[model samples]
Target: MTSIDASKLKLPLQMLLMGSATKLVAPKTKTVFIEDLPPEEVAKHAPEPAGLVNLGNTCYLNSVVQCMRSIPQLRSGLRAYVPPPRSANSLAAGTASSSPLLLSSLRDLFESLDRTTNAVPPSNFVMATKIAFPQFAQTGPRGQPMQQDAEEFYSNLLTVAGGEMRGNCLTAGLTGGQSAASAPTPEELDGAENLADALFGMKMEETLTCDEFSSAETAAAASSDAMDIDNNTALVEPPVTSYDLHRKLVCNIQGGSDASAQVNVNHLSEGIALSLSGKITKHSEILNRDAVWTRTQRIARLPPVIVVQFGRFYWKATPDSQDHAGVKCKVMKPVAFNGTFDVYEFCNEKNSKGLEEVERCSSSGGRRPYRQKAQGRR
Candidate 1:
């Protein structure tokens, strides 16, 4: 074989190796075809500009790049980051509308590419002012994205300041060509405002917890009505109305702690059912005769032997004034009411064993030490 030239081979080989190393280190554009990526994988990879910076290609993006280009299939990668518009609701964090500039840029680009115009992104304030509250804009000062009513005046002026109807603007239903009738006057508007304030302030229902009941302020409230009326006749007034009913809790829980849970609570699958209309009032009277909202004994001379009803049993009510004021009525095991609610489940029960015993005592002295022998449950 002929002797190789080392000087000639070394220069050629070194040039090739140095060029390869420089290509690996340099920030060269890495183009990817969307068709090459799986549809699901595109979202995972392309995502937004935040993820794009990791791909290292968000800056210097053209303001009006195509969504999908023809030649090498180039597209504005930033379009993927822009949020979806809402008239239709979506479970996305960027549901807040984008600025007008962003919308116009997107719309023109998409339309130029002959693509669908799905998103008309408006800022959150724009949505609130323009869409949710168009009437306010009709009354308040209007500027850019000018309403047609405001625009006619604007094109005439150099730059109008505070030029929208500040006075009360009105709209009337002219349709159906109604017979002569007068518009609602200023007196009606004042009444409407009062009604609005009342509605906004009202609460549907209220609840208090065990800790609330234990408060020193609440203890005074727990005092019997009779005592309160007698001691402070000038300050305390008679309970105008009262309702009551008695109900024995029949169902027993396997665990004592589970048994004592509030029956009305959301976690409980089974509910204490009662006749939806009159039952709560009837039950409330039997339990806490003094619960003013019940209205059961407000007029009547009170029935003897208030029966504690639950399921099939009418349990006995031994009149006692232990926890209550001296004036007592047959108290249900755990009575609850929210005006319209007929059944009350003692949400306050701490455990089940005590309740089970109470049920047995009330149920015509049914099984006293009711204990089931363990089978596979053991």
Candidate 2:
């Protein structure tokens, strides 16, 4: 055996240990594949876009957020949103100095998603959402988050976002130019002019007129019956006739008997038309007589975007089942629709005539028809 100098061995030992430590902490690199690239990268090469990570059973929330993010105007509005002060934010803001928790969380989430190529966890947003709306925090038997309806989340989020946007707009207006004396109260602010309304709100005029006065003879009969012989006093009024704005529309599912005749997108249009079409509803309030009323609705104004929710799940009668009451079942019907939908027929006289004029002008100008067609979506 030959004895070696300890000084020479010390340098070699230190170098070996240092090399191993560097290897342990160094970044690893692998061969890059186009197919395996993140969606943000793929989007540059293809049309693919990134997806969100499912936080528990938060697919409902993810779907709505993705849909909203797809809207350019909506994304721009949310990006521009500056959280109002705590005084203006009426929503649940955990801290006194913080903005509305849900809105702030949503804005932050969107920013994070736009910045990252990887799937976002949305954990903070989910926690903020659960704090703002306990309903979304529903727990299953195992104490995990339960699955929720997408439409319910969509509607609720829109309502909350709209309110916050409107409140912020009011605050901005006050701070920009309006004096405190001239500023309107929160109650006086218009609710129909928010970001949500600008992006997807629609106005509809609903007319409800009594059939009792529809004909001259029926009108005369009603008038005669309105007089009291003993008191010699007349009611001096007609059947209930009213008009108002409709904020929402409900589509009913309709189909034939055979399974092959299952409801489709056409059926959806028909259902909407049925609701807007004239229908006589029986009433028995006036003069102990069977009065009738005809109700109708027309599009007062159209929004830039339209949302169509299919009536998929329904409560079905299950007579022979153990429950023997009813069961919630999803409709297996295959609905088909083209890229464009013609809603010209559904508009009121003013809107219909306006569309016609626009079409004529466009044709005369050698441009594409100015017809507004709704994009069919599921």
Candidate 3:
């Protein structure tokens, strides 16, 4: 065997060894930072618009948030709100027990949405809301998505927002001459105050009457004496009544084919009418034990904003279920409505004629009718 000298290796073998060594070493890669790109390019590459994480079935919350955001007054008010400072007690609780944190989170969420065109995931807002109101944190059996009523969620949100406003008002009032001196007066604060009132308040009058029967002794005495005494009657005074801004209008869809019949075509107006003149039956707490009928009627005042909630969900008997009770289901029928409607027709008699006169004058003057887009759930 002939041994080859170490320095005398073949050129082809040496070249092959060098190539293998180069293959063993990894090549350097170039780093690209977002800062190095153009502003427009950076925006294009930004993370997809934030969207709500579907933590379980949170569609109910998402829907309510969308609807609430549509209200310009609410949006403006919430935007201007600055949450109160956290307290030591609240800090000890380890979570926000008041509206401050929740409102802050909401403000952050709204800002995020405004900054980005895409819908952001309201994870922080949702968590804050859940902490403030535990009912929203409830889960269905086996950790399933729970279904919630949109109206209920809306009510809860309004309650929180209203509470915050009331608390702020009270604080301002109590801290008299400090910041209250500089605060807007009742006249100057009319805009936000009126908006709040219009969104949540209503005024009404209630008339109550009593029907009583004379006692046996009194009856016998009256009959024996043949005297006309008003002992069996009592004079009742009417009471002032107040109602919430949110109105629930119910539709009886049983045994109907047409849209008008399925849902009372006049539901919106009729509901207002009925609420203005509804009867209440109650047992009197007085010694006479009389039956009382209280009639409610709307006052001359009306709110700037009116929320009408259709009673679409009802409890019905479930077929093929022997042990279970009635199940609640939504009415899936469509109700037709126009772009504009005159609610003046449903106002009290005192206001109805006046509104009619105004309408006639406006129509004769060739002025355009006030057109409002009515929104409803089918």
Candidate 4:
């Protein structure tokens, strides 16, 4: 065989490489359509709300986003976000670019939900979020999509959104909206102390009292001198200091029934308030006491938004098997709730008294019937 010259083969090699590159970089195309309708017709018959396209097992994120969008205030505030500058050499500056990308993508996704007539995929938002938080960018061992806890996702989103809000507030103050004194510091942002106070904060006062018990020697001496001592004599310890904090109220479900139970949100709130008020036998490490009765009461205030989490899952011991010894099963009991209800009964005495008249009138005959609102089901 005749050997080809090296220079003669150079052009063919370059052409081959170019061809491979073209195949690797081919563009993907997607087609989208919108129905044509007159402005009046569109206004009269608004299109159904769009559903989110799940990316992998991202239904958890979609559920949270949908719920957040339902709140007009939060949706509007997020839409009005202004990203901070990324010029500083600090660690915060390093993350500024990625954070803004996630925020902007989220805003865009929300805007699309409002404008689009059909289901919209949040591909850009999901990708940007995954880039910002690498821990969430995980795949299953078998190459299937991984699942995430909805509560954890909600908490992370809140923290990120809170940071952005703090940044925006600081930028506004520096740009002449307010003085630097009014600007929130990084510590405040990290804990979201200010936002928590403004949105879901409540004031609670807790009281603790120590139970009196006679020592063994004192008890024996008292018994010996029982005839000489007065029967009305007794010793008492001072009450413990009252503790106060800004905290959110939590409602816990006590029991589950096989038959479907009608759950009233207001009733659940009342149960929490009542359960928190009673005394509990608690050991005090600081006071070196074996037993102490502690009581918690809601002195005043309630959050603008109340978060209720139903205890619907529990761990149950199953018969020992080869595959597993126990399993965590979800409660299948149906819980019915109304779209809106008054929670005045659960509030403190002062607050409940104020709402009694109004609530009584609105809830005449001890029953307030509510019409079911249409909701999109997955």
- Please give me the total number of clashing residue pairs in predicted model 3: 5
Of candidates 2 and 1, the better by TM-score: 2
The lDDT of model 2 is 0.62
lDDT of 4: 0.56
What lDDT score belongs to each candidate, Candidate 1 first?
0.27, 0.62, 0.54, 0.56
lDDT of 3 at 346: 41
Ranked by lDDT, the better of candidates 3 and 4 is 4
lDDT of 3 by residue, 101-186 (tens): 77678767766655544556888877887787788888877877576677776677766766675534433432332464555455
Model number with the top lDDT? 2
**Please, what are the lDDT tens digits per residue for candidate 4 over residues 283-351?**
543234456465656535554455444455556666776788778776555445457645554556765
* Candidate 2 segments whose C-alpha is farther than 4 A from its true place: 1-46, 87-99, 167-191, 222-250, 254-266, 277-290, 316-327, 364-377
For residues 55-78, what per-residue lDDT tens digits would candidate 2 score against the true structure?
Answer: 888998888777776666565555
Q: Can you give the lDDT of residue 308 in candidate 4?
A: 46
Candidate 4 worst ten-residue window by lDDT: 369-378
Worst 10 contiguous positions by lDDT, candidate 3: 247-256
How would you encode candidate 1's per-residue C-alpha lDDT over 1-378 as one tens digit per residue? Answer: 999787666543534333443435644776778767654455445434111111111111221122112111011222222333565453265454433334344334443333222222223323333332344234324442332222222121101111211111111211112221543344433222221111111111212122212444443454342332332222222222322222122222112223433333221113232221111222121123333232111101111111111222123334574664443222234332222321113222222345455566786664332222111100
All models, RMSD in angstroms: 26.2, 13.0, 15.1, 19.4
Q: In candidate 1, what residue range of length 10 has the lowest lDDT sum?
A: 157-166
Candidate 1's displacement at residue 131, Å, is 17
